[model samples]
Target: PALHRQRHQFVIDFVKQHKPKKVVDLGCSECSLLKKLRFHREIELLVGLDVNGAKVKKHMYGLAPISTDYLQPTYDQLCIELYQGSVTQEDARLRGFDLVTAIELIEHLTLADVGLFSAVLFGYMTPVAVIVSTPNSEFNPLLPGLRGFRHSDHKFEWTRAEFRSWALKVCLDYGYEVAFTGVGQAPQGQQESVGFCSQIGVFHRIGGRNGCNMLLDDDADDVFSYTLLYSIKY
Candidate 1:
């Protein structure tokens, strides 16, 4: 649970540093991270997408601005939205965002779906930066009574070397460079050997920002597969 908080904080710190106006969270079940992100004054547009429409709809109202928000308005406007869809599908609304995050989400998909996700996010959406976090299989042995992957739904968890190898190939296929870091240190003696409980990859596009030009594009070919569930403008 502490590591989960750290994952959110890690993205928050990134927003503070980069001040990305448009951000989206892929596989944002329950909209928890989106709720946390709504408070940042720098973000103009915040979007969350998940395949489970009912789950997202159930918690999305909590993201609405409170009475205090209306009484004491900020200078910048924030448009928050939730959508129901698979991450492997391309949506016109998601393209060209300043930041994209997939927190503890990749491991849930099968290997084939993972390939589709890479192509959709890195190739189609092409955000300026992307943050992805997944459990480190190497650390599973340390958890008491834990047998297989952390979640029963997780198709496959990658060991440190396996994760790095996949990330490196993603960077190469897409024009981005990646840096690896993580939260949840191992026990003092085994820290060096097991690495973090959750591993993260931060990716930045190469060649002077390739996706900005299409930020406001209205091309007919652009697709909108995700169903809009809720939206609020402030």
Candidate 2:
């Protein structure tokens, strides 16, 4: 549980350092991270997308400002919304955001879906920066009595070497730079080999041509598939 919080903290630290205005959380299951990001004045627009529309609708209300928020409002105006959609599909509404996050989501997807997700996220939506985290299979051995994958829904897990290789390939294909980091260090004596329990990949777009300037065609811009569930403007 502590490590889980650390994974979210890693992302929060990124937002603090970069201060992106428009941010979206891909695969935002319960809007937990969105709830945290809502407190940051730096973000102007916050969006959350999940394939489980019902789940998103149920928990998204937690992101709304509380009574005290109305009394002591100091943050900048914020517009937050939730969407029901798949990450693999292209959504015109989601393109060109400053940041895109997919924490602990890739392993749940099949290998084919992962390819489509990469093309859509890196090649199409093209956020300025993307943060992704997944369970480190190498650390699985240290976990007592843990069997195959960390989660039953997870289709596959990757070792540190495998994840690094895949992240580098995405950078090469999509014209980006990537840095690797993780949380939950391994125990004594095994720390050198196992590394972090949750590995993270931070990808930043290279050069000036990004999602903002790349949107030119009217037909492509008309593509909107995700259903808008709820929105709040403050």
Clashes (backbone N, CA, C under 3 Å), per candidate, total 0, 0
lDDT of 2 by residue, 1-234 (tens): 598789889989999999999999999998999999888879999999999999998898888787777764577788999999999898888877889999999998998999899999988888899999999999999889999898999999999998998899898888889998899988789877898999999999997334245743556446788999999987
- In candidate 2, stretches whose alpha carbon ends up further than 4 angstroms from where it belongs are 208-213, 216-221
**C-alpha RMSD for every candidate:** 1.6, 1.7
RMSD of 2: 1.7
Clashing pairs in 1: none
lDDT (0 to 1) per candidate = 0.90, 0.89
Identify the runs in model 1 with alpha carbons over 4 angstroms from their true place: 211-218
In terms of lDDT, model 2 sits at 0.89
lDDT score of residue 113 within candidate 2: 95
